[model samples]
Target: MKVLVIGATGYAGHRIATALRRRGHDVTGLTRDLAGAGARALAAAEIRPVAGELADPAGYREHLWDADVVVHTAMDYADPAGSDRALIAELVAAPRHLVYTTGISLHGRVDTPELDEESPSSPDNPLHFRYQLERELIASGLPHTIVRPAFLYGHDSRTSQLGRWFAAPRFVGDKDKRWSFVHVDDLAEAYVRIVERADAPLGDIFVIGEENPPPALEVFTAAFRAAGHAGEVTVHPISPEEWLEQAADQDERVNSAKARRELGWTPRHAGPIAGMATYYAAWQAANA
Candidate 1:
C-alpha cells in the first residue's frame, strides 16, 4: 500500500511513517523543510520526504491524491482547531483511507475511573474544537479511522515534558492527577495495525495507551531519579479556576482494550516509570 504521512517530521508522524515503511508499504512523508534535520532523519530511514504545508492543500494535493492511505498527524498549536478544520474540509473532497490523530486531552476531565473510546467528552473540555473536528470527519462520509492516543512519551517526545521536568522537577496543579501514557514506538505500531486493516470499516475509534496510569508526582519523581537527579520534586498548587481553565487537573487514566482486541495492537514498552532511564537517555541524545 502507498501511504502519505503529513507532518512526517513531527514527533508522532515520523515514527508512524517509518513504521509503515518498515511494514513494506511505499511511504512518503510531507515535511515543511526538505533540508531540515527531521527531513534528513527521514531520508536516513529510507523514507522519502516531500515539502508541503497542511494549511495549503494545493501544495500537497498531488501527494494526497496519490496515496492509498493518508495519515494526518500534523497539528498547528497556535490554531489547532482552525488548522484541522481546513485540512478536514480538503480531505472531505478527496476521500481515501484516512487515519486522523486526536489526543486523550479531548476527553478533558473524566469523572469515570477509566476513559475509553466510548467515553463522552466532558462539557468543560477546553479542546472541544477537536471533538467538533471528529464529528465533521465522521459526517463527511469518508472512510476514516480516528486514533486518540494517550500522553505520548519516549524517543525524545517533548510532549512528555520529562526533559524540562528532569532539569526542574515539579508538578503543576495536582500531584495525584493520573494520566495514561504510551511509548512512541508502541503508538507507531497501533498506526501500523490500523493502516493494515484499513479495509475493515470506517468510523472506528481507538484509544491507544498502556493498561495502567500513574500519578503525575510518581511518574515525575521516577523520571528525575532515572535522569540521575537526586532531589525532591516541588509541588505547585493552583486554584480550581486556574486548573479548570487548563482542563488538565483531573485524572485521565485510559483503557486501550479496544485497540488491543480489535486492532490486535499490544503496547511493547512498559509504562513510563519502567522505561524512564532508557527514555531519558534517548531524550538527551536527541537534544544533544
Candidate 2:
C-alpha cells in the first residue's frame, strides 16, 4: 500500500514512515517545509517527502491520488479543533482509511490501574483540545482508525522525557509522578500493523502500550543511572504535575490489549528502566 504519513518529520510519523518503507510499502512523508527538519528526517530515512502544510487541504490533496492510506500524526497544538475541522473533510474523502494518533494522556491520571478503550476520559487537561479533534473525526463517517498511544520515550532529544534528568540529576519530590509508556519505535510499528491488517475495523480506537509502564520517579532515576549521574539523584518536593507542570495534571495508565489482540502488535521494549538506559546511550551517541 502507498502510505502518506502526515507530519512525517515528527517523532512518531517519521518512524512510521520508515517502518512502512522497510516493509516494502511505497511511503510518502508530508511535512511543512521540504527543506525543514521533517523533510530532512524523511529524506535521511529514504522515505519520499512532500512539502506541504496539513491545514491547507489543497496543499496536500494533489498527491492524495497516490495514497492508499493517510496517517495523521500531526497535532495542531494551537487550535486543534479548527485544524481538524479544516482537514477532516478532505482527509476522509480521499483515503481508504485515515489513521489518527491520540495519546493516553486523554485518559487523564492513573496510578498503575489498568484502563482500556471503554474507560472514560478526562477533558480537563491539555488533551481536552485534541479530544475534541478526535470526536469530530470519528463522527465524520470516514473509514478511520484512532491510535491512542501511551507516553512516547526514545532517543530523540525533543521527546525523550528522560533527557532533562539524564543531563543532570535533579531533585523531584515524591514518587507519585507516574505514567504509562510505549517505546517510540513500538508505537510506530503499531500504526503500521493497523494499516496493513485488512480486517481492521473502522472507527476503532487502539491504545498501544506495553505490559508495564514505569513510575515517573523510576524513569528519571533510570535515566540518571544510565548517564552515570545516579549518585547525585535526589527527591524533595516533586510537583503533582511533574512533566507538564501544574496546569497539566496527569498521571495515567493505559493498556494496548486491543492493538495486540487485533493488529498482532507485540512491543519489543518491555521495561522502562532498561529502555531509558538504551535511549540515554543513543542520545549520548547522537549528541557526541
Candidate 3:
C-alpha cells in the first residue's frame, strides 16, 4: 500500500508515518519544509518527504490522489477549523482511504462513567468544532476512518504537557478529574492496524487509549516522581467551566473496546504512570 501522511513531522504524524513504512508500505510524508530537520529525519527513515500546506490543497492534492491511503494528522491551532475544513473539502473527491485524526476532547467532559464513539458530543466544549468536522467528513461519503485518541504521551509529546509541569509539579484543575492516555508508539500501531484492515467500514470511528485512566493528581504525581522530584505536588482549584475551556483539564475517560474488537488494536505499553520514568528520559533526549 502507498500511504501519504500529512503533518508527518509532528509527534503523532511522524510516528504513524514511520510505522507504515516499517510495515513495507510506500510512505510519503507531507511537511511544510522539505529541507528542514524534520523532512531530513523522514528521509533518514526511508519515507519520502514532500513540501505541502494543509490550508492549500493544491500543494498536496496530487500526493493525496497518488496514495492508496491518506492519514491526516496535521493541525493548525491558529485556524484548526479552517485548515481541516479545507482539507476535508478536498478529500471528498479523492479515491482513497482516509484516516483522520480527531482528539478524545471532542467527547467533552465525560459526565458518565465512560464514553465511546457512540457517545454524544458536548457542543459547550471549546473544541466542539472538531465534532462538527468529524460529522462533515463522515457525511461526505468518503472512505474514511476517524480516530479520536486520548492525551498522547511518550517520545517528546508536548501535547501531554508533562514536561511543562515537571518543574513545579502541580495539578491546575480538579485533582480527581480522570483522563485517558495513550503512548505515541501505541497510537501509531492503532493507525497501522486501521490501514492494513481493508474491510473496515467507511465512517468508522475509533477511540484509542489505554484501558484504565487515572486522576489528574495521580498522573502528575507519577510524572514528578519519574522526573526525580521528591516534593509534594501542588493543587490549584478552578471552576468546572474554566476546566472545560482548557480541554486538557476536563475528564476524558473513554473505552477503546471497539478499536480492539474491530481493528485488533491493543496498546502494548502500560498507561503513562507505569512508564513515566522511561518516557521522561525519552522526552529529555528529544528536547536536548
| Candidate 3 lDDT, 114-189, residue by residue in tens | 7688887777777778889888888888889999988788888664566665554666876777888888899999
lDDT of 1 by residue, 37-156 (tens): 989999988889999878787788888889989999888877877777777777778888889998887878766888888887877777767877888888888888999988788888
Against the true structure, candidate 3 reaches a TM-score of 0.94
TM-score of 1: 0.93
* lDDT at position 135, candidate 3: 88
Alpha carbon deviation, residue 123, candidate 1 (Å):
3.3
Which ten residues in a row are the worst by lDDT in model 2?
Answer: 241-250
| Model 2 Cα shift for residue 25 (angstroms) | 0.9
Residue 155 shift from truth in candidate 2, angstroms: 3.6
lDDT of 2 by residue, 8-105 (tens): 88777888889899998989998778887668778888799987877776777877657888888887766666766777788666645888887767
RMSD per model, one decimal: 2.2, 2.8, 2.1
Q: In terms of lDDT, which candidate is stronger, 1 or 3?
A: 3
TM-score of each: 0.93, 0.87, 0.94
In lDDT terms, how accurate is model 1?
0.83
Worst 10 residues of 3 by lDDT: 238-247
Compare the candidates by lDDT and give the number of the best one.
Answer: 3
